[model samples]
Target: MKLEDASSGSLGPVIEVIQSILNQTGYILPALVLFIIALAIKYPNRLPGTTDPKHRPGVYFPPGADPLIGHTRMIVGFGSEGQFENFKALSDATPAGSWNVSFLGTSSMTFVNRPEYLEYIQKTNFDNFPKGSQFTGRLGDLLGVTGIFVADGHPWKTQRKQASHMFSNREFNTWVRAVIHNELDDISALLDNVTAKNGPGKLILPELMFRYTLSSFAKMAFAANLNCLSPDPDSLKRPVPFAVAFDRAQAIINDRFITPGWYIWEKFNKTGRDMRSSIKTIREFGLDIIHKRLAERQDEKKDPLAPVEGTKKEQLKKEGKDLLDFFMDLTTDPEELLIVVLNFIIAGRDTTAQSLSWLFYELMAHPEHVPKIRKEIAEKFGEPEGGVRLDYESFRELPYTVACLHEAIRLHPAVPKNGKAVMKDDVIIPQGPNPDNLPPVRVFAGERVGWSDWVMARTPAIWGADCEEYNPSRFLETDEAGKLHLRNFGQWKSHYFNAGPRLCLGMNLATYEATAFIAAVLPRFNFEWATAAQGQKSAWPPQYANSVTHPIKDPYLVNVTRVKA
Candidate 1:
């Protein structure tokens, strides 16, 4: 089925769920009444010097910020690319490579683009910068309050420790590789069928990638074959409803971050109502999955044929344990299980899927790299017909292919923007001596600080003058053997997977899956821009949706053909 059909199967129950959420706003009414009173006091700036905006020292307050509305107009009005341009302009305006803007005169937000400031908040003083209440509050309803993504302090540590097992274990790595290989085989078959039936299909790449990654992750995480990549359209409907609702909920929640006093306006807006309904559907589906897994575990325990106690890990190695099995060992509470599982899905699926979609875009833009990538794959795994799959160790040897993937993300990071809240007053210091005359910027408690990897990715100082160019060679270096090797551009320079204590838990798994996918498909299929009708430009320099992740605004239409080899 097409991506649009994900929510098509059944909506009668969803509408009922929406009405149920709308009807149960008992406390929301009182909050709305208080908000009205607050608005009366807040809207008309009564303080002295309120007619003109007041600027703070060491802060670049760009034009168009009204004293009454602040930057709310741009935040709400601008598209994703426009917003990126605004931040890029701000980064260029200051030597410190960061800027601040007020919101509704009540709160201020700082946008950090420099590597020094990024390290300061994400790594150096990580404890002081947690995903505080403001950030978590925006996401609490969708991603549960206690999930690893929303949690801070001890709760986050506990979940992180438990989840770390999957990445650290060698056996689990091998198991994950086999699962990815299996998924890629299925994708190849589906594409092969399409090519046989028709000459070349105009594929929406992001949709296809998302489905492939979702199905792959579902198997590794829950041992459930969602078959979201099924050729049979009817079989695809079962999981599409939950997938659609999940995607909608994430996009809406991300908007809450920039919308000033969002909680106040959300109650009365259509966006807010849609968010509530989406959350209801998401939670219902998640709870059902959790409960069914729990029941299966109970049945496993009673089976006399189950693995003996001491050999359980070995048995899991052979049978391939899902992430849910690990979490079940940690907690029996259904709510907690649901939160972690959903968080796992977001981490394991969305980021990598988006990254690969953009990778293909990069490949299309620079088709010369296609032969290079395919040659490297052939050297390592023979040819597509040979059916040789890269395991955990062998996948690491394809340095050039991995470099292309790295460079693609360097330009278009999946999680392009991330931030942390200040716990107390602090001064942000640049890493090097004050060469640019960049002064230290003081930040107070209760303020938010964010960094845009998108801007940093294109910064002239960080990546030289040709930073905008798509060149995979930048991520490689010649070693003693005279062969190209992947450069280790540490966390600060390569901050896509994040850094410090809150680093991405699924980084290794994501890398393995993406590289393996490139290996699998490049040898068998070719991609290029889909032909456009007269007067159209084929959506060059792709536009992105203003969502939680960097999703292509429209369908990423591409021409897919089979290789003659």
Candidate 2:
């Protein structure tokens, strides 16, 4: 009887524990199974110990990528400062000049740094790879449906054709030149005033360059003077509304690139709200310009042969029209006009401004080149009594100046990387230092591919050991007669302005503007870093804002002194 009582006491607690576990298992089992199934569905190839045999055998990835999340943890961990560093690390690890990275599960991004891959994607398989919907959708709010930067297929082709005509027009080019000259004159005046107020004062060159480019484009495209660089008391107090809206819109749009499932985030978060507000501001600003331009056009039509009212309108003739007038003739849709004008303004403003800023940065960093450029400019254009006379013809004559611009662009490309979406299954055969002798990489449909011009321009294998150095003479060659001439590297090998059918349409205009602006300014001012500015060291390889155009990360400040005649 004693033994039976002892057994019962032990058995009672054991039975109770068994029953409790059984009851919990019923609920827990289903959730566990569901979680496993979700992982299987999302990352079938990513399960621990299971490798994807389908990927190019030599393709590499960062170590310790989670099966469920892939490289997301590492990428997110890097934050902003280390984002490009992560890419550089991957490139260094691989011998194929490419690497595969996954954000979550099987969703992957293949980064290609090979020149051959760039050619294949941009030219050989142009139709197969496109600026896919994801890219266009992300930029849609800012660029609109018709803007060439975000457009694809038919729309892109149509806009490119029309824009080409506008860009190539003699009258339009003349008007652009006039606008550039006027803006430069204003910049000179502003600098003079600053010098008078605070002798040898520090000037933020990037900000000044932005104002110059923005004001030039505003006058050329919108027939409105932003007076962005003006020292006028009225202009100083009130900022240009369009300029502010444009910058805000650009920042918001660029943020979408890093925002995962951006479409979803845009729909359900503060980012969406901010983007909407910026879009609204941009739309309203554009509409105001369009309305004003339409009224002006109507007035001109109502009274043909009447003398044009403003200095800007003088460029408009009954036979030849500026871009705004041309687009207004094509479609009265205010939104469409806004899209076209904004596209031009964004392209013309950012790229040129960033390019000039970097050019000056390089010049200040290497002052020895300044005298060479100035001497070249003087020899070609001749120093006038007042200042340099910069026209289209004279702009092209400065071979050394052009080479310097090219070198600067190479070191600091305005657009550092270009991306495309694989529309169909494609194979890329990478060239240059295929150390592992890797086979072609098969990119499945819907996969993303990116190429870094910045990387290619700096790679030792591609451009030789001194690729990182800012040597303007690299673009120049001496003839048998010992006279130096510009070597035409062309767009394909350079890739600075991109390549193939979709090459930047504003290349000529941008080149002309940069040349003119530099010519006008370099002859008059001696530029160097301010003592305080010098103390602020820019990060090597130069940090960049994650914008469509990767502008310099920090403000570049310099002191400008007028050159004595």
Candidate 3:
């Protein structure tokens, strides 16, 4: 046969076979897609590990959620600024304050916004719910894999046991108070310089608060001065490398919570690169601090009494060393030491600073409360004469001042949301009598449970009718003697520093630091929103920056006028 004819004869059958297969696939493709859709619709809850709708009859699943992604779009849609709006809406939609939804198809999250459920999860059945891989996987790089924040079970227990000393030690706490005072001197100097240079309100209080707390924490934890709260005009304008990197890393880490397949994209994306660079800066700074301490420790070992001890104060200082000293005694591993110290930095720096920013913002917005706080401060310290100095004992006397702090935290919790993974199939029984009449919801192993203190802070059932209002009075009571006392709202209701075993290690220190600033500063200087006071109302509920902690968003400027003695 001719070459062309021979080729055509051989190719014809193969081409026909190919054509037949393509034609069949054309019909089969649509049928397969339709079948998958129908299957999804029919058995939306039929996945191997999802909670069946029938099983969670009491829970509200927000409508318009994709069968696969569930309410993930609601989470990932908004930037950090509006991140919690959807959660607020969801909380409002379900009066009972419990909801179940999936994130990446198979992974499920059960939210318990009620305070009682929080008590059950955090205290009653604490062990069943660990922080889980979902949380550790995202935050591990920045927070450290074995850090106190990420550790569970025995490691957590051991870390907690050792770390508790800083909070509980009388002498150490006194040192922390002294450190806060020293840092405040820098803040005061900055405020004076800024107001003099640019007039009142040149200072952004949140930024200043972060700087103040970073400096305080560095001293209190590491005994190394970062000088983060420098008064220099140029320094005020420029970001501190360690502080900037720490905050940036946390903000980036917050993104991973909502970004689907974040791991895959983060490996190749600018955001991921930025996060790594930030973390590297943090790690290097941490290691540098660790190495210096190790060197000093070795020297101390060489000559036990080389550093001469002075007075009672010096003895106490030596007896109650900083957090780094405490951890250095426990382990010499630089990485481990860095992890624990960084975890406390989050507690010392971010939580206290953000809490104070929110507290002061509310105080500035509602100046009516400022007088009450000042009045309480004066009552406790006897008129701020010669500038009142607060010791550890003094903090206990300012119940009203502490109440105001608690109230502000209730409205704007630093750590707004937290969760734990369910170890096995279990049911959550609402605490109290279940006023909302919510039924028990069953959770399977591998699923996670979460609580939004931010939403709970606004829930009427939890905080009463004036939940949205910035009312510190809700956390207080008037005695027959006409004295204001803070009512114990318990850990679950307050829920800012958390509750039970995982309760924030630095809660006492945080309270002391923030209240000291408020007591000392508020008594001496008036903090007013410079622009907002000029007839423009600040946002009714202050907006927050999306970070590991909920910080007041920008435009945090405040005028600091010295209160007449």
Candidate 4:
């Protein structure tokens, strides 16, 4: 009875307290309830940066954008290489060259597609544009601080001159070319394996292509060979850590657009940990080499710097021979040197491999095109010596093949989106064609512009109604006298090798590697669909933004067959 009475007393006090509170706040209660109700009424459920662009006051979404995530959903469903069609549709939905895209953390950013506009930003206003901090800062692992990819100001100039002088000069080309060509070993081995084992039936997708390129980069860039492809070899060598670090870094940069907090949040994620560790290894590796060389400085056997005696003597006596050798010729900023060279290897390795894979796919799908390309090769160089190579001039002259490769790059470039910052408050690009029938654009400081490569490559305004088609014929132009000039191959005389002072330094090398690899493989081997056992799940049914324009994600398990002689 005492317990029951105590419980009753507690209930009574609680009821009394509530009544007293309600009585004291009689006027405020209704207002509070009304405020809560009004908020729910005014704004329904809203995700960050996910809203109707037309109705939003500050950010603008393009016309017909889905209120939630805008074009994000549509783009996500399309694979990197496969996204061209959707990009075309979205492109056509707006102005030819200029439109606002919902990006950079759920906000709408401008998308520029016209050739003239690209040419201007590339050439005239090159000084004002640079890769943004957001893109570079994510590389906290692979690059210690600054790299040729991220640095601006006079620093970039110093690095550029050093890099270009070493890489572009004749001396570096001689040794570097031979080193890169040696990677063809893997390419040949892969083709021979495919041809001998598979016959005309099974398809083997090219995942080895990734490992091959990575190993090749080791040889060309560092004068070391990290063979990821040897039988019974552990593919995850030091290069894996380095490559992982770079991939995760770029991936985190890409994620900023979706979650916005990915870079920070990923601190606790698996890739983030891997990336951090990889950076430590890279630094240690670099330091070890530096110290070893210093130790060897006093030795008489073989000193790379033996020719240079004093501090200024060595400074005055550098030449380009390898990628690192080129970096050695440049500035003495050790941090920048390590960072930029690592970034360069990342760029050179994977992108070229991707292009080659796509080229193979295109060749197989368009089998007839293969014979034509082979005919061109036979005519130009003739009879296949196992080591028969096409020099730079010969590689450039294969118009149809070059056009086909251009089409592939156009539709499926490695870097799908370009991120650049508008330097200074006064920089603005006005819209309209530059007497060449192109669109107009304007840019401002702090504003980041990401022009979609797919949009520019396949936009109808740029490439006509059949812009999305993978037809090499589109790239061909026959003169009145029936002679084909190089102009017939690219819609823009430059097909996304990019334009301006910031053009890719590795363009010539990349093209040579890609063309040679393809020329060597296509005529000799045949690839079909991969086996069920070989197929792995693809994250690419809907590709993330981190990839090159595309990836062969469905675990391509194609058996290979040697072509009849």
* Predicted structure with the largest lDDT when compared to the true one: 3
In order, candidate lDDTs are: 0.74, 0.74, 0.75, 0.58
TM agreement with the true structure for every prediction: 0.85, 0.88, 0.88, 0.76
**C-alpha positional error of residue 354 in candidate 4 after TM-score superposition, expressed in Å:** 1.2
- Model 1: per-residue lDDT, tens digit, 1-565? 6433533557656655545655797568758777766754563432222222233466676667654456667666654457777778887887667777656523667887877777778777788889988767888887777788888988888888888986677656766776777777777776666566567755667777888888777667655555477654233335576688888888878877767677888798988888888888878866766676777678677963444332222233355566777888899898888788788887778889988988998998898988998888898778848245677667678888988898988888888887788888787776644456656666767777888888898898888899989999998899898987888978787888787777788777777788888887878888778767522233786877777777776756776788873
Q: What's the TM for model 1?
A: 0.85
- Candidate 2 worst ten-residue window by lDDT: 44-53
Q: Any runs in candidate 4 off by more than 4 Å, and if so which?
A: 1-60, 63-89, 101-108, 197-205, 230-241, 244-249, 285-320, 331-334, 385-387, 423-444, 478-485, 488-495, 531-549
Across residues 492-530, which tens digit of lDDT does each residue of candidate 3 receive? 777888888998887777888888787667787777776
- Over 4 Å off in model 2, which ranges? 1-54, 104-106, 231-238, 305-320, 430-439, 533-542
What does candidate 4's lDDT look like per residue over 1-565, in tens digits? 5534644675877666656767899768868887766654443332233333344222224444343345555444553345555555656665545655554343445556666556556667777667656555655445544667667767677767777786667866665556545556555664554455434533334556676677666555545444455432233223455455555555544554445556766689875676567567767655544333334344525655564322212322343355565665454455655676576776677677777677766665667787787777777666574534656446677777787787777677776666566564332343344554433444445555557776676666567788777787776787899866445433233546666677777777777776776676656666654434656343422233345335556535555677663
Root-mean-square deviation of Cα positions for candidate 3 versus the true structure, in angstroms = 5.3
Give the CA lDDT, 0 to 100, for residue 347 in model 1.
76
RMSD of each: 12.3, 4.7, 5.3, 7.2
lDDT tens per residue, model 2, 178-291? 777777777766766656654575577788878888877877776765656675423433577767877877887766666557677678788778778777887876677678
Q: How close is candidate 4 to the true structure, as a TM-score?
A: 0.76
| Residue clash pairs of candidate 2 | none
